[model samples]
Every structure is written in structure tokens, then in C-alpha cells.
Target: MTIETDRLRDLVAAELGRARDRTTLLTESVDEGDLIRQHSPLMSPLVWDLAHVGNQEELWLVRDVGGREPVRRDIDELYDAFKHPRRDRPQLPLLGPGEARRYVATVRDKALDVLSRSRLDGTPLVDQGFAFGMIVQHEQQHDETMLATHQLRTGAPVLEAPPPPAPAVPVTGEALIPAGPFTMGTSTEPWALDNERPAHQVIVPAFHIDRALVTNGQYAAFIDDGGYDDPRWWSEAGWAHRQSAGLVAPQHWSRDGDGWASTSFGRTQRIVADEPVVHVCFHEAAAYAAWAGKRLPTEAEWEKAARLDPATGRSRRFPWGDDPPAAEHANLGQRHLRPAPAGAYPMGVSPWGVHQLIGDVWEWTSTDFHGYPGFAPFPYREYSEVFFGPEYKVLRGGSFGTDRSACRGTFRNWDYPIRRQIFSGFRCARDA
Candidate 1:
């Protein structure tokens, strides 16, 4: 289906608006001190994220695609993510929240002007609003980062969204994904990131994956069985990290009387047993899998369960179908501050009846972050190419913090094995 110039422009504009709205919502509630404070060394300050969002938009949309002069040219180095490390961001001469907001607003105005006049076809960057889409996705990605910063910030709750609907009925057992070759990734998704490009065929052996994400209640059982205490379940490196960090349970979790409570945003509440476990690093997930006599699904296995429709023998844009995400489809776009109960969103299940494959928590896969057979970086190499190695592990699907534009079956998320501050989780898979 060819996208017309007007439709493409509208889509770009709408996505840009949504990205800005989410960014504002995430940052505006906090005071200036909160915005400038470095909540965690691993993350940039909120104000830095705020300005960086605009700086990136300006780079891709106004400067690169529009072929226009730079606005606030000198600040480029200050906001250059690759140039400056997260820990050093607090020492830079950063823009205040008011100035940062104005800068982004000005950049957005100019970008929209470019969108209105520029042709949507010619080069890969301009075709299908690729640059525009990239900018929107970049901003949304920062929005997610800001949300993570909020999670790390020590203060009263500054964000809130109503809980998602309860599951109609719990999906009690694993779903059997048939053994076969299915199309993985995509060569056709217009807005797909570079890593998810060039669709390919993958043959997965028969396997049983959980119908829903592993719940807090289930993980608590692992804890009760001394999953963390015993070194047998953890890898050598994982055990070392666990001991060094003194990790007792998932980050932000603690014993509240006889039960457990978790801190979200800033409020501490009793752990919801039915909800998918969040904040567990790859090690924890791997350990939990070991405790249960299961294993983390390979990236290919996760993609097959998510995108491949056995009947059609093709990969859909999302798990449910080729439709954009809806409220009932998944918990995404910061619509909820927490993951809904596992087994919810039956409508979001894949063709093979794998539930909640698209949202709730980004499920960790037992695969290293690597490129495909025909992998080639477009626009820039730093986005995905720089990080393809054994140092990072792959994560599939999206979490509650993910924007719909950035969430898809083929979208690849990876991180160092030890990092767990993001909204990450896992499910167990076993051979059939």
C-alpha cells in the first residue's frame, strides 16, 4: 500500500504531537530541582533528556532532512548523547526546563514547517516520512528514559495512571507453538527501526511458552524456594553481580510484613501477584527460568510466537493483527503506570494464542544482540550497529513505558546483562 504525501505528512505530524505530549506529561509535573537532579548515574538528568529530545529532532528533522541551518548550534555538543556520558551530564552547562521546553517547541515549529512543504519521496530519509518517524520515535524513546528517571527519583509520586482492567480469566498453561519455519522481522514495515529490517525465514523447534508473562506471585515462589540464595541457579557472572550488588529480590521490592511491596513512580504498594514481574535483570530471569526447570526463549522463538501467524505463514506488524494499538489491545504509551494482571488483553494474543505478547513488560530472550544475515545500517550506524555484540542481551515486545510508535514485534531492545532499572521482565519457555 503506497502512502500518499498528505497521509504521510498527517501521520508524521500526529506522531510528533503524541511524542511531545508524552514528554511534557512526564517532565512537567516535577520541580526544577527534580529535573536537574541526577537520580541515577546510569541515567542522564531529566533536563538533559528534555533538551536532548529537541536537539535530536532538530538534527534529524530540521538539519538533516530539511537541509536547513542549525538552531542553537553551539548546544549540540552539550546534548550530544554519544559525546557525553550519562554520569557527566550533570556537570554540563545544561538548559533549564523553561529554556529546554522553548527550544523543543521552536524546533517542532520549524520541523512542522518543513513537513508541510517538503516532498515525502526521493531518498530513504524523506520517503514515507522516515526522518519524521525517526524523530518521533527518538523523542518517545527519551520519554521512556524520563519515565525511568522518574522511577529512580526519590520523592513523592509525580506520575499516575489508572490500573488496567483485570484479566477476565487467567490463562493457566503454556501455549504450544508448532515447529516450523516462519517469517521473522520485516522488510516492509515503513517505520521499523534498522535492526528489525530485511525480513528473513527462521525455523523454530516445537516449544511451549507461557500463555502470559510470569507473574509476581510466581516469582515470589522462586524467592521462597531460595532461588537467589542458591548459586546453582545463577551463572558465574550473574552470581558475582548478585553478590556484589547485594540483590535480595527484584529492584525496588522489599518485605512489607508477611507480604511484598514495590515502589512505582514513588508510591509503595503491595506487590500484585497476578501482574507480570518487572525490573528483573537478564540474570534474574535466567535464574528464575533455572529454578523452574525452564529457559528463556531465544529471540527467534520470541519473534515467532509474536509475529508469525501459522495459518498465514507471515509476520504481522503486531501480535494481534496489522492494526495500530488500541486500549484493549495492550497496556502501552504510559497509559498505565504499571503492568496489568497477566492473562489480560486476550485480544492482543497472537494467532497461536500467546497472550500479552506486545505489552505489559519487555520480555527478556536468551539471545545476544546481533544483526541479521543481511544487516546494514541506514541513516546512521550508531543507532543499532554500535551495540551488536555479546555484551548485551535481547529483549522483545514492549512494556507499559513504551510508546505505540516504538513498540512492534520486530523492534529490538537490548542492554547490558546487569542493568535492570528499565521496565524489564521475563517469561519461561521449555522444549515441547
Candidate 2:
């Protein structure tokens, strides 16, 4: 291996280790009952996630990349995510915590061995350690999902993190993004998934976007104004969904006397008025935007705000620059269980002065989830190709629970319009 290859190998191993550590932190504090219990029909059992992480690693790294026999072929079907729905996972014969830990540890040992001797070039899977990066990212994604499970579990607080730093100054009003064509996606980002592929030019008209995400105080105004009750502000579908679900405010939030409070990861606390509103679905975000006489930015507009630099006319890797996220730059990587106060992370602001565009909450965009022109799926179609359509809305940026490896300026997240289990929020956009 060359110097570059050696460095890549180390980075891949380190990321895998970090992901595993996060998974352990999320699951180890709970008893076996918690691990096996499915918190919601939308989410798998914690133990299923644990073993699925190992099963995916074994399939991709040990079986496919190394061309080795399957270590535990009998369990392969049991852990196939596509074959089994999350609702049925608890009934399956999932590996217990002890067995799951041992199994994954064994898989990791072999995967590292494969990494040690395997060439990091040729083919898309092996080229530039793509397979290794994929596995690391996959585990990190599942770690985020497991964290969500922890939040949905009805029990005492198991996860803990200090609150994020308060904003230095309050950010008010909006940023006017200049109208023109800017690169929307990435062709150079190594670990970028298929949906964010084939960087292309996107021409957006002049627009005004919120300087920061909508704060709890701001969202409170909407709730106080009866934003949910006013059907004029909601799309027909959104209104129907809201009515059926009986949603009055953001999920996990409740009216506490004269104020609002929220529960997260089994811990209940008063809502921080200055922090960005979270646990909101796309419908809620859209309705808030509509009530405020604004609209959700399109996926292209969101990307341009986060990536384009007007002076140089170039797309940056992040809002700040090509440098990776740091504690001072953005609130991410499970560093804080909740979002920082809006207007925080001035260091992470985009060239247009859009604050907290990279992290805090996954910002909802108006566009539906779809592929760019000339899109092609690599390795498998299930990852991105199959999910494209109107059913899912695009969400830009990452949340507090998102790992840096799984997030980027061009990274895309999607979910149903009414889903609010994830840490989702939005910044409004309007015509300039």
C-alpha cells in the first residue's frame, strides 16, 4: 500500500471503531428487555440493529470483498433488512446481546484482517477503500437509528450529553441568496452516496432564506396562532394527514402550563425557547412556512445555500469550507442530545451567512426525493434507486445524532411527509 492507501486504511478502521463505540453507548446501559423490545412499529428492535450491523459488515466485507465463506450463513436471512420489516423483527430469532457482541467482534476482526491485505484499488467497491467506507457509514447510519429507538423507548434516561453552547448573538431576518447557476451535488466526494452523485449545474432564481432555522419561540407563535387548525396553510395531503394523526404541535412536545416542554431519549425537560424547533415533520414545517408567508426551500436551493461561494463561484465541501466538521463548527455526532440555540455556530455559517446549515436539525426541503439526470446506482439499487418518488421529501443537513462520516453538504436524507420520529426541522425560504 502507498502512503495514501495506508492513511485511508487507518481512517476506515477508526471510523468503524467510532461507530461501534456509539452503538455500545446507546445499548449497553439498557437491560436485555429494552434491547429486545421494539419501541415503535416504524423501528426495529435494538438487538436487531446490533446484529444487522454485523450481518451487513459480514456480507459486504468478509463475504463479497474478501471472497470468503459466510461465517454464520444461517443468520443471514434473519438479518436481511429488505426481507423483513421492522415491525416483525422482534419475533425473529435475533442474536442476544452477548451473542450479537461476540458475533460482531469476530466479524470486525476478520474485516480488519481483510483490510490489512486487500488492495484498495480497482472496481467500485474496492477502489479507494469505498467498501470499507460504505460499511463504516452503514454502521454509523444504524447507530443514528438506534439512537432514535432509544428516544422512542419508554423508560428512564439512558443516554446523556451536556447541552450545546448558547448562541453568542441572536440572528434575525433572512439572507438573500444571489440568483444564478451553482453546482448542486458532488462528483468528487469519495463516500457520497448514489443519490448525491453526478454533480450538475442548477440555476436558482434569487431567494431569501432564513438566517437560521425556525426557533422554538418562532414555532410557538405558529402554534399560538392556530397554525395547525388553519387548513389554508397546509397542503391538502398535509391537512388530511394532520387531521388523521391529530397533531397539534411537534411530536414529543406538549403544552406545559403556559409554556412548552419536550421529551427525548426518555428524559423530559422544558423546551429551550432559543433552540431550533425539532421533531417536526415535513407537513409541520411546510405549514409553519405557509403561515409565516414563506415556503420551504427546494432541495436545489438548500444545497446552493450550503455549498455555493459567490465570490469564487465554487461549491464548497461544507458551509465553512473544505475542512471537516469540528465541535466549534457545528453541533453533530451525538455531541448534544438536542439542538443548540438558533444563531449558534457562527463559525459554521455559509458564505451567504446561513447559520447552522450543516448540523443541529435535518432541515426539510420542499422537493420530493428523486434522482438527478443521468443517475446510475452502484453496487445495489436498494440503497437509493428504489426509494425515489413523491412519497419521500428531501431533507438537507444532518442532525445532532448524525455522524460526520454520514453527512456532507450534498448528503441527502428522506422520509415520509408525516414522519416526525427523526430530528427534523426547517428554515423558510421566499422569493427575493
Candidate 3:
């Protein structure tokens, strides 16, 4: 179901407030020169990401079609996130930081009005709901990017203050859901993204999924048991990927005493075994599942189980009910700058009694990342076609470093098997 106008407006205001807090904190005590520096190969200059805080919201919700134009002509010349990925973003206009901030403020004003006044739920001004969803998700995404820029450029308060002394509670539960004639894609609803659409039907049989993600401890078991060395566990592609990565364990993990642990933000901590595994690629997930006699569920099966309508609620835009993410829901976001323990978000659980499905990490599906039967590539043809070769795999649900608005139960993303970073992770499933 779609969120109503008033509620959507309220959400917009709240998101703007959060964004302002982060932006203000990030920009304080910073030289203008540093804001323009590209911090990492994966990131953009702070100025571009800052402008996008307004650019993305306006692109779809205001300037594109949702509202009357706020800025004058040639907006794209000033801010177009699609023109380049963050790493190569063009410098912000030559205006002083104050004037630039004012320009950004105008864009936000336009977005606020559009989101507040537009009739979006049923007959959206734009034909596809994604146009709006993209804006929301983009803002949420910038919240994280803003934080990352602050951390990389300057040692900002990236971590939560009075941070919990204890680490995440390890996840440990498993559920074997009995599957049937389950709908595999979006339900009959107005405004679903095309990638999630043309609602189709599929049958999934009984299967078991870990109650939470495979934790650092569990993966450590795989390592102690020679999980990484055993080529038999790896898919042909997985083996090649691991060799290329030169990985013996998760990217950030380290051995602490007899057990394994991981570090983030320069803090060394013990690993939690009950949590789902993170920083793994499709190759590693596949290998681990094979070793454990489990398998990565197909997108259909994973979605089916997640759509299970237990007492908590119905199949929502997320495994949780139809609300945007919160810090308590999952280890999402820059709220904590690291993954919360898996299974921590029972409130966000799907009908299947799964935990942390929404936030901790994006789970890999067995299926290749392909278009649906009636899939039509809109907006840009190259987006879905250029990556259609045999190299990529589909990942569903959102990951920790993800934009909340861009993500949905049905949003699709993919990566080559060899890449690993803070954002990727996996869950395990098996045939019943």
C-alpha cells in the first residue's frame, strides 16, 4: 500500500531534518578545498554529494514532473548525479559556500513543497512510483554518504556516542517455511517500480533459512573447518573470485584469541556468531551454503518466505511493516556506522519470522540478475542491458550502507562475485 500525502509529507520533513543535522555536522570546521576532494575511489567530492541532497529529491519529485520548477533553467548543469558516479563528480559551481548552500536550500524548498502538496499515493504525477521512491531513497542514501565524507575527510563523530559497551548479540535461529503457490513479485498495488512489477506467480517448496544471517562466529567455524581452503565448497566462479580477492575470511574480520572478530572505525571488537555474515560476495555466500548443505534461495523463494504474513503484519514494502527504517529496526544506515547484530530487528521481521532482512545486508539469490518476463528497460536502456552477461548475480533487500528510500522489498542490485566491501553480506537457505 502507498503512504498517504500527509504521512508522506511528514516523512519528508523528518528526513530533511535528519539530513540537515548530518550536513551541518559534516560541513562544520571544514575548509572548502577539502569538500571538493574525492575522498576514495568509491566516493565523490563532498560538495557534489551535498548538492545531491537537494538534487536527487528535486530531480524526480520536483524539477522532473512532481511540482512546478523552483530553480531557473539549466538545473542539470548545476547538479546531475546520473552524469557521473560520486568518484568523478564535477566541482560545485564557482559560487561561495554560502551562496551554494542557499542554492541547495532552494532545491530543498522545492522538494518540500512538491512532497507536501503532491497527490502521490494512487495516481502519482509520474507514471511510475519509482520516480518518487527514488527521491526518498536518494535522500536516505545521502545521509550515509554525508557521514562517510565527514569520516574520510575529517575525523567526525561518525560513531554513536556512549556507544554500547557490548557488541551485537549473535543471531541463532532457523525456520523451515513451508512454501506454496506464492506470489513472487510486488502485490497488486499502485505505483510499484517496473523492476518489481507485472506481479507474477511462482511455486516454492518447503525450505529452511537461518533465523538470522550467518554470524562472524559461524563463518569463523567455516574457516576453522577449513571452509576457505576446501575448493569443493566453492562454485567455479566463487573459487576464482576468492583467489582474486586473496581473502581467507570476511574483508574486515580478524582473529581475536581463539575466536574471530572484526574492526570498523578503527575499533577492534569480538565477533558475534549469531549474527548474519557480512562483507561476503555471492561467491563466498554460495561456497558457505554448499559447505553447510544449504543453498542460497532464489529471489522468488526468498521473497516468498519474507512475504509470509505472520501475526506481525502483511508483506510490506519491507519485511517489516510499511514504515521507513529506524535505528532500532536494523543495523541500517549511518545511525551506528556498523551493522547491528543480526536478528536484532524482530520488529522488522517479515511474516516468515526472519530477522534483520531489511537492514543488515542484502542477501544473494541463486537466480541470475535478469529482467522479468515482461521487463522493459525504461529511462535508460544501458542500465539493465550492459550488465546482462554471465558475470553478475542478483541481490535483493537492502544493505547497511544503502539508501533507505532506494531500497524496498523488491528493489534489485547485483555485483560481480569477486568484489567485497562494507556494504555486501549474505543469508543461507536450503531445500526442504
Q: lDDT winner among the candidates?
A: 2
* lDDT of candidate 2 over 118-220, digit per residue (tens): 9999898898888888898899899989888888889788888998998876788899998899998888888888899899998999999999899999999
Kindly list the per-residue Cα lDDT of model 1 for residues 1-432, writing each as its tens digit: 245778888888999999999889888989999889999999999999999999998998899888899999999999998999999999999999899989999999999999998888888988788889888889998999899899999978878788888987668788899899988888988888899988988889999998889999999999988999999999999999999999889999999998799999889999999999999999999999999999999999999888887777888888899999999899999989999997679889888788888888989999999889898998899999999999999999999999999998889999998889989999889999
On a 0 to 100 scale, what is the lDDT of residue 269 in model 1?
93
TM-scores for every predicted model: 0.98, 0.99, 0.79
Worst 10 residues of 2 by lDDT: 264-273
Candidate 2 regions off by >4 Å?
Answer: none
Which residue runs does candidate 3 get wrong by more than 4 Å? 1-11, 16-34, 66-100, 114-132, 145-157, 161-173, 187-191, 255-259, 310-329, 376-390, 400-407
Minimum summed lDDT over a 10-residue window in model 1 is located at 1-10
* Candidate 3 lDDT, 277-313, residue by residue in tens: 7778778888888998888888887786666465542
Whole-model Cα lDDT of every candidate shown, in order: 0.90, 0.91, 0.66
Root-mean-square deviation of every model: 1.4, 0.9, 4.4
Query: Candidate 2 at residue 28, lDDT?
Result: 95
Kindly give the number of clashing pairs for every candidate: 0, 0, 11
